[model samples]
Target: MASISSLGVGSGLDAESIVTKLMAVEKLPLTRLTTRTAGYNAKISAYGAISSALATLKTAANAFYSTKTNLLTSTVSDATVASATSGTSASSGTYALEISQLAKAHSLSSRVAGASETMGTGSLAISNGSNSFSVTIDSTNNTLAGIRDAINASSTNTSVRANILTDTSGARLVLTSKETGASNTISIAVTDNDGNNTDAYNVLSNTNPGLSQLSFTAGGNNLTQVQAAQNAQVKLDNVDLSFSSNTVVDAIPGVTLKLTKENVGTPATVTIARDSTGIKKVADDFVKAYNDLHSTIVKNTAANPSTTLSTSTDAASTASALTGDSTARSIDRQMREALRTVPSGVTGALTQLADAGISIDSSGVMSVDATKFQKAVDTNFSGLQSMMDGYGKAVNTLVTTLTDTNGVISARTTGLKDSIKLLDNQKEMLNNRLTSIEKRYRARFSSLDTMISGMQTTSTFLTQQIAKM
Candidate 1:
């Protein structure tokens, strides 16, 4: 009938301590569940490490499939005159390139005119060789600044740019051709609504016998030429060629030339060659990545007996998280098989990876012999390429299977997580049962303590009665 807190006071017994000991015994299942959850978490972490290593290996494997794997490098002898770039289609060759002329943009400036002065209501027709467009100059946009804005806003005004140049003399309207070819010439004509007062158009046009908007000759209103339009002149291997743009790609096959400055006499040598260094680096990276993956597998799956008398001791093993795991073992075995087995569809003495100078040691580490690889590549480049392609394909396929959405690694991690969730649920249920058991133990102990207290009180009263008699 007594409460748990008052049980010890009634009979001088440690009832709460006894209930704690009973609850400890009842919570054994919770400890097991906790240990299992920890194991599952460790396995998930181990799978994560494997996934990261596989991702690195996949990247290295993908490099072999790239067209740029046998990429070419280009160099220009005189960088001051020009620069060069090569693509996959480029072959190893040399060319003597001379830049006779650099492409120039056509620039023209109007005669001195007040910056704020209105040009009057009219339309100005502008042409760039093949295409012609008009800009309407209304009262709102008749000023120099307004006309500049209007020209920029015209959708059809693609070949020319307009700017107002302010000097000590006054402000002038400058028009420049957007393109750099001689064919891209600038021409302009004015149509005035106020025929007599065409000051805006006159200030910017040449008033010669045949008045033109682009000419900067005498009889013009002091209109000056800033820079004339010129086509880029180049001599490739002594043959003259002209280009509309300084950036020429068609001058040489699979090569793009960027002309920097005009060198009438000086020639810049351009060369394109196979990039052996790049190819070798890719091969080196593959070997390193392969070795890294192999090492990780060995470290995680191998057993250690140094820690104790038992050869199956887990404490001394490097892969505590993944020790004795079947999935880990399977991954290691598959990777080893991929490395050892030669790809199918090849018939030659150089069919295996060892023929290409890629060798694996007893410790599961891979290395490439540079001299042997170079000799193999020089003799049979196609064979080497095919071998790497086959090997990369096999590795890529295996990696994808293990790392994909429904992959073994992913599924295993998910399973472990689910197991941990189950363990958590089990722990919760065990804790609930233990809580109930503790409450029952306390209730029973409290009742026993109350009964003992009552019996002792009865014994004490009887002894007092005997003494009085």
Candidate 2:
């Protein structure tokens, strides 16, 4: 009739220990499920690594496509004079670049006056190139600083930037054209409210007491031209060329020249040629990418031959999850096959990767032969490029098939995931069964403990009676 708080309290037997051992046996399936899940997860991670490496390889291969393989480099004899950039359309040639004058933006300075001096109310029409905007000068914004702010804040004033420059002479309103070139000259015309816009009497005045003094037009000469807007003049290959801006793009096909300084008599030579180093690097990168992908596959699918297995949980310590996996094997096989197959539309001594100085070793690692590759690039650049383009197209197609939604890798990953989900469900059911088994074991052990305790008490009474007799 007594209630026991702890297991095995009423009996000499260790009921708790027995129940724990029984439960451990009952939960064996759960442990197996856990191990299987871990294996599946490791497989997924291995595939992820392969996917990443394969994607990089795909990118490297894509660079060999016909549209992307232009590797021209431009060089300048004198960087101080000008720097040049060549594009795909640029033909290999040498150009004589002589910059006569650098394009200048038109800048005009008003007569210096007090920073807060109030000028007569009027409207000023500012023109730069074909763009023109009007700024109204009122009592609210008639001072030199106020006018500068108003002009800058004008919604339509996109061609000119207005600022007030303070010097010992005084504060002068400076207007600069935003664009450079002769046609972009800044001219300010005034509509004075005072009815005397010319202000010829104050033409030499530095104060600019009226808005008319701000005019720099045919009708009036008020604002002084600090810098003129002139086109950039250059003699490219002894041909005089004029550009609106200092950055000349149309002067040469696919070449942009940035004129930094004027070198009138001395001409700097610009050479456009095939970038042999860049071309070699591209070839090297393709080979390296393949090697990396190959390494990943090998590492993931390698067989562990040691009899003594590692107990470490680290993924690297254990046999790879992808070991003996059909998908991994197929990927490796397909990739190697792709490398061995000759690219279509490519003919010559440099038709295959090996011909272009890329070769695979016995261990399935690809390498580039620098000497041979350089020779191929120098002598058979077009042929090498054609081979690369064809190979790139083939490899890219293979990778796309392997990594696509319904691809081999994806299907394998999905199958593993499904297996994991099923295992998880089975584990849940097994856990529930183990929970019931533990409850039954505890109940049975409690009953056994109660019986043993009652029997022992009876035996002790009997022994006392026998001793008394």
Candidate 3:
């Protein structure tokens, strides 16, 4: 028997076209599986958007629970004399603050000498309060500039800073205590290699030259005290208080006072009070966050209203990614329930969010009544705080459960993913089966074409024999 080279040459049948059409029908199941998988992916993406919105809402809700009271703001009548800041521990009150003295750091100067003149080589032991460090002077670093650099570069020299000051007299090595306080006064003891530490009697004496010129200890008077270390003294309501530093924090409860200048006779009033603006801002943020989350849920779960027109470009139809989905519906229902339920363990006239001037409208959007909210904050701030705390705790708990690792949204997403995976596996199996079916169809058509060609040849032979007779 002869084999058919082309599909339809012998039988005059369009076998290739027929096989293609049959394969198209056979692929219907794969196409359906792909479409279903795409739908599942869309649902998963919709859940992701919902989770992000819920996370934002959770942050805003947590803020309300954390803020214990209205934020406090402080002011000073004389900002030039002093500035103040208040913290959560501060109580609303006014204090008459009188700054008699600002803190000063101790500064000492070495006897004037030539800018590049070298003093005798030795080691100088320097101290401020309990901190002490020694600087060695050699021929290489014996000059005034060299001594300044050596003192500053000492790794353990934490209490004092050294600098070279040039005047009409000459160059002087100036040492200043790094901190304020009489106890932080600087003292320098010298081991003069020249063997005469007390030989220099006057500030201008360079004759008995040695490292003793830089000493300011009781045994030597080579260095002069330029500035005295003193404490900052202030009077709060006729009570005297002193601090080692100008920035006073412990003197006032929950308040830090920064003394800039002395105003002994004239006292500045420091007032700390509740900040109404800050409270209102927090309330507004909470409402806005809830509205955003609510909007997202509504958009994802909204059903398209019945329409007579077949072709419609309405947003309602386009926005439905998880429409009729049980997970989306459950989340929406739980959130609405949280809003309607009254928070437990709350007391006072403003026990609920509505009582504190926060209300949800029929459209599921929250609104704040500014006048009412401010009135509640002014008259019953404690009550308003309690209500916010209660509501915030409740909302935070609900949002956490919904967006956590094993949350409803996460579970739904996981289920959708598993469904897509199954659909993909099914699609693979269906495609493999369709391949085998197409091969069988092609083999049968080729055999039929060869058989028909042989029959046509036999018919032609019989007609030739009859014509001869």
Candidate 4:
């Protein structure tokens, strides 16, 4: 190692310890800056936490609002009502309505089976003049079945199939030409190898022999052709209309028509009645959603946001009160006011939420009485609908608080981020200034070391001179 005196002559520090001590003293400002930065970061993190929590809460609020309002809206306008029978609105103590749609039927065009086919348990050889091939028929081992599978397996020009009405009085083997538009006809000359049926080989075509009429059980909708469209002349609420399709179409409001019978036994009747399922479902969904919102509020601001009362308790209350703020209750009052105010231009069935039986409690949470709810469904659904209608504009307003721009969470988060950036800038400035201070301190230490080394050398020279004397 170089001598301490050499260190002093070179850079001015008599010893490294002197440089270290001064440097530590100069670093104090930097240490203070670092502490400030740490504090800033912590504040930013806390603000971020609050912003994120609010964002989530805002989302839950939106869903809760949408569900309750939609349920109310649907309950008012929807056509579904349970407990009402197929016909007669409220004529029976409990009844529902269902409308039926007509079924579509299709007919097949009889064309020549141009391709060759094996029929009725047999290995058949097919020849159309020069071109010929033999096909073995098997149902159990091979997925192939009936004459249709065999002919389809034949040459590309020909095809095979089965007719449903084969046993009918006009039954005939009518094979269709694959290319009826171009080729127009198919010729099949076959040699059957089934043990008992040798004479069954016949060329299938429109000219040779028509496939026999089909013989089978007809479905509930009889194939029997009617001269005109089958319809029942019925009075829907004293209004006369023809019922032709199933799921009876409603001729008027608050009614559903349905087919109670098909063909024969009794004259198929059309039932007209009121529907209540839509309203009841709305009320149920509203209750569930309201409870969810109430729970969220209680959890976030309550002694506990997630307080759930024990089932064994004499009274079970959901955690619903807003975070220690009675304002939450005020908010509910505002929501109720919003619900009560119905804008014009409403249409169909139920008109309001109150008509449908949705109400708010003093605590700001919605609470539904099932009995009152069902009674409203049974008696006046439009009133409940009106109550739901009041919330539309208000909900829209509340949802704005959650938007990414100008939203409660967004604004706060953005401000925090900016503060963090500023803090970071401040920290960098502090570091730069401290670095300059440290450099200055180092320079001063170098000068002090030089002075000390000069003194030490002078002392040595004096000692030597004095010894000579």
Instruction: Please tell me which predicted candidate would have the highest lDDT against the true structure.
Output: 2
How much lDDT does candidate 4 score?
Answer: 0.43
Judging by lDDT, tell me the better candidate of 1 and 2. 2
Clashes of 1: 0
Between candidates 1 and 4, the one scoring higher on TM-score is 1
Highest-scoring model, TM-score: 2
For each candidate, what TM-score against the reference?
0.80, 0.87, 0.73, 0.38
Off by over 4 Å in 1: 1-11, 67-71, 111-116, 124-135, 154-179, 183-197, 204-225, 304-319, 336-350, 381-386, 446-469
Ranking by TM-score: 2, 1, 3, 4
Candidate 2 on 268-314: residue-level lDDT in tens?
99998888888877877888888899899989988677623445444
Per lDDT, what order, best first?
2, 3, 1, 4
lDDT of 1 at 153: 87
Evaluation by lDDT, superior candidate among 2 and 4: 2
CA-lDDT, candidates in order: 0.76, 0.84, 0.83, 0.43
Segments of candidate 4 deviating more than 4 angstroms: 2-110, 115-262, 267-278, 294-359, 392-469
Better model by lDDT: candidate 2 vs candidate 3: 2
Compare candidates 2 and 4 on TM-score and give the better one: 2
Candidate 4, residues 302-395, lDDT tens digits: the string is 4333554454221222332223444333433444565566545544454455444566666656655667667765675444444444354345
Model 2, 75: alpha-carbon shift in Å?
1.6
